[model samples]
Target: MKAMIKVTLKNGVLDPQGKAIMGSLQSLGFNGYDNVRQGKYFELDIEAFSKEEAKARATDMCEQLLANTVIENYEIEIV
Candidate 1:
């Protein structure tokens, strides 16, 4: 099975990197972009038998090592 995980900063979190990107874009003549946020995507190949198991394991991975739970939120999708 394949598992895809997306991790991103939670609402109200300060994202300096995102802000910097926005500034750079504006400097390059990109306009009207009010906001920008960055996130991470991870794809994993696992030996789970079913989508449910893959989802569970991926969720555990996210909680254990993939994301900083204190400041980030994650979502898991199994394929």
Candidate 2:
């Protein structure tokens, strides 16, 4: 099974990196984008018997290490 975890800063948290990216995009003539946010994308391969198991394990991975729950939120996708 394959799982993906996307981690992003929670609302109200200052994202300097995202701001910088927005500035760079505007400067490069890539306008029409606003309030841009950046995040982490992780792809994991797991040996699971079902999609539920894969997602559950990936959720655990996010809770334990992939994401900092205090400042970040994560979503899981299983394939």
Work out the TM-score per prediction.
0.93, 0.95
What does candidate 1 score on TM? 0.93
Candidate 2 on 7-40: residue-level lDDT in tens? 9999999999999999999999997769989999
Model 2 TM? 0.95
Model 1, global lDDT: 0.92
Candidate 2 Cα misplacement greater than 4 A, ranges: none
Residue 76 local lDDT, model 1: 91
lDDT of 1 by residue, 6-54 (tens): 9999999999999999999999999977869899999989898888988
Evaluated at residue 74, the lDDT of candidate 1 is: 99
* Best candidate according to TM-score: 2
